[model samples]
Structures are given as structure tokens and as C-alpha cells.
Target: MTFEEQPIDYSNYLPDAPQARSVAAEMVATRQSEQVKAALFSAKQFPRDQQASFNRIMQACQRKKLAEEAAYEFPKGGSKVTGPSIRLAEVLAQNWGNMEYGVVELDQVNGVSKMEAYAWDIETNTRRSMIFNVTHERKAKGRINKLDDPRDIYELTANMGARRVRACILGVIPGDIVDAALDRCRQTLKDGYTEPLTDRLRKALLKFQEKYGVSKEMIEEYVGCGQDAFTENDFLKIAGVWRSLSDNMAKREDYFNITKVHVPSNAEEEFLKLQEVEKKEDVVHDISTE
Candidate 1:
């Protein structure tokens, strides 16, 4: 047949010709299966040593920064509730060995996203998984606002997923180890404040004011003590509150009872300026002015 008379084979273009979707799915399943098999074989070959893992976790918790961020304290029902933070949980899982942990977004529909947080003990074949739904909205100041931006939705989902992932890891890990890590973190925080107390207090006050719009007066009201009366224990509690606030583990209202922040008057501003000058003069050496 001449080239002009060649037949057009429409089979390739037919609706069901290649089954592309099924083929792709099969490939994905096969790859996932291979990964699982490899993970299991490797875990079997090299198992985790419990004592070594414990030491590693405790050592990791000894770092001042990690220990500082290790736990958050929040008030509930007229009592304080404290627990290991997500950062600490993640450290534990990493050192625990032969573990798989992650959060995955399975689907999003109708302003709600479905996600799964999972942790697996590869050597022991123990697994914990939690599936939950996150609504793409946030309640703030008695207002319910819907999130429409992609970035906002992603951040909301990730934040929610992180808490769930933390819980899953905690579920699989031993309780005693987590408790020990918390204790170590507490000691680290207690001893980590090597700077001058005045300097630490200044920085903390500035931070709380700048970050949360909380004034020194508000803090005094909350703690029932003025700045001069503040002790090392008070500073530690403030640090815990800061960590809790930074991680979104608790709200300002939960810790402070301030409904309206008072604006300083002109006289108060002048007093603060005088206080600052005196504070600076206290550190400055007396040099004779000729």
C-alpha cells in the first residue's frame, strides 16, 4: 500500500486502550511494597538497643535550647497542666531507632481536610495511627474566620498534623522515658540562666510585650508580684509560659486575665525613661568629666 493509503489505527487513542491510571497505581503500590520490605529487612538485621536509645534521648534533652523548648505548661480547670512538647517528642522518636513516623494529608473537601498521623516500630512491628479531620477555619476573639488562602490552609493542616504526630509518637514510646526527658529539661532550664538576672528579666519583659502585647503591669497582676520581688522560680514559670505561647499550645487568656491593656500616660512614659537612664547608669563606670 502507498503511504497515502496507510490505515489509521485508532486503538491507541481509544478510551480504554492503555489503562494508564491502573498502570500508574500498580507502579505506586509495587514501589511502596518494596519500600516496606526493605525497611523490615533492615530493621531485622540491626535492632535497637534500649539502653543506648535511652542514653541518646537523655543526652539530646540536656542541650539547653532543646531542653528549654522541651515542654509547655498551660492552665486548665484552676490547675496547671504540663507535658512534653512536640520538639521533645520528635527527638525521642529519632533516637528510639527503627521507627517510622509522619503525617499525611489524604484529602481535602468542603473546607475540611482529612489527615493521618502514624508512628511505627519497625523492629517490634507495633504501630499507632490516628486519622482526623481539620476544618479550614480559626476562631479568634469570638469570631470564626474561614481560611481561603492556600498557604493558610496548608499551615493550619500542618500545625494540626504536628500535634497528632506528637501524640502518635508518644503513644508508641515508653512513658518513663518521656518523663525522664521532662525532668532533665527542667534541670537544664533551671541551670541554663547564666546571664545576669536583670538582663534576663529585661529581655523577657521586652519579649512578652513585643510578642503578645503583654505589659509588665499585666505580668505583675498575673503573678501577684512586682518585678523586684520576682525570683528564679518565677522566671522559670515565665519561660514555660513563653514556650507555651510560642508553640500555640495555649492562649494569652488562659494564663492572663487581662481584658483590656492600659496605655501608659505621659507621666508614666517619663518615669519609664528615667528608669531606663538609671538602669544604664548603674552599669556604666563613674568617669570623671574634666
Candidate 2:
């Protein structure tokens, strides 16, 4: 029997080596270059109609559901942070025409994820990209816990990537277009829904209470008016606050004064009862001894 020595492929172990990394990088670069060329050719052949694009964006924003989710609000430094939401940005990017945008998780190493989000305008050859890192950690009850579970890491990465992707898309799209879409969304929300205004308001009250322990009274107080007097603008603001909470962007306490009253569990109740009995006995003993 004879043994033959085989050459080692260092590329397998050393990804940073020129032979390994450069080849892969070149392949990716070539593919992306072809895509860009194709997009530019298509754009030249069929240019975007600005008015049509504007109308499409406005029409999408006019929908009640889209309008409801068009913007988000979060509290920061004793002030409110409000802006167009990722959902709205997606709609804008899609309707804006001749634009391409997406987010990609490039790599993960040492409990951190490297991600890239980009938006490119094929017609004007305008491009925007954002590279960001997401740390695999979860904060709960004022404590930071490192995430070991793949599902948790993936979800956290996705949520953070969405905001970056939104930023890139918005960067490529015109500011005026985004503004017009937001305005349309506002008007759509203000116009009220097919359901009666009272019914919708009641549902919103129930939703907030069930989801966030926010009572109708708290909501009224926040808006400085009762539900009956709640204006369209007030409802929009409430929706924004809800978006902030749903996305975990802010806590309920940030926007509302949530007074926590500890309810006794069975164990706690028994402990309290035992304490009361002990106190009674001590009181009786003190009186007799005196």
C-alpha cells in the first residue's frame, strides 16, 4: 500500500487570505455590476413618471390601515420622537419607481451580527447604503442578558436591520415625496373609518387597555380630553404612541404615568395573613406584660 500527500487548501481556514476572500469578493462584485447595468438600461428604456409615482404613493397612503401605521413615535429626553415608520418607507420605496432597496445580514461572529442595508435609484443612478452591527443582547427589567438562542438573535437582528433599511430607502427617495405621503396618511386617518367614529374609538380604548394596561381614563388624560372630545389629531397621536410601544421602542411608562399596584399572589397572601396574626399576638403579649 502507498500513501500520497495532498496539498492543503488554506482558503478553508484563512478566509481573509487573498486567494479566498478576493475571489469571493470579485464574484459578488461582478454579479452586482451586472445587476446595476441591467437596472440602468431598464431605467433608460422606461423612465419613471414623477406624477404617476407621486399618485401611487398618495393612493397607498390614503388607505386607512396604511395611514394608521404610517408613522411611529417614541419618547426621548423628555420629548417625543416621531417619524415615518418602516412600513411607510417600504410603501414609498415600492411606489417611488425605478428604485431598489433591501437589507442583508452579511455575517455573524462573536455574538454580533454585521448587516448592510442599501437603496439605489436606477434612473438617476443614486445610491445609499448603511452598514451596522447588532449585538446579541436582550434587556429586561433593567438587566442585559446575552442571547445564545439562534431564534432570539435572528429576531433582534431583523428588528434592528429594518430601521437601517428604512433609513437607506428614505435617503434615496425624495423628501417631498415622503412628506406628501405622510400628509395623505394623516388626512386618511382624520377622515375616520368605515366604522363609526365612536366604535373605532371604543375599540382603540379596549385595545390599549388589553395590550398595555392603559385605561381609557389614562388615554383621555394623555390627550387632555375625554373620548367624546378626542379629535382626529389626538387619535393619530395615540396611534403613534401605540406604534412606539408595539415596537418596544419605548415603555408605557415613558408616555403615560403607569402606577403599579402589586396584587398579592396566593403565597404572598398567606405570608401577609401570618404577619397579621403574629402582630396581634405581640400586641396582646405587650398589653399583658405591661
lDDT of 2 by residue, 1-290 (tens): 99899998886675566777889999999999998889899999999999999999988987889988899988789777788999999999898889988888999899999999889888998999989999999889999999999999988988888898899988989898888889999999878567776887888889987677788777877788889998768877888888888878888889876664333556887999999999999999999999
The TM-score of predicted model 2 comes to 0.76
TM-score per candidate, chains pooled: 0.79, 0.76
Candidate 2 residues lying further than 4 Å off, grouped into runs, are 1-25, 260-290
- Candidate 2 backbone collisions, by pair: none
Residues forming the 10-long window of minimal summed lDDT in candidate 1 = 281-290
Task: Write one digit per residue (lDDT tens) for candidate 1, span 1-290.
Answer: 65676898988777773687888889999999999999999999999999999999989988999988888789999989978888999999999999999999999999999999999999999899999999999988999999999999999999999988999999999899999999988888778877977789889999988778788988887778999998877888899999888877788889886666775656887999999999788667454332
Score candidate 1 by TM-score against the native: 0.79
lDDT of 1: 0.89
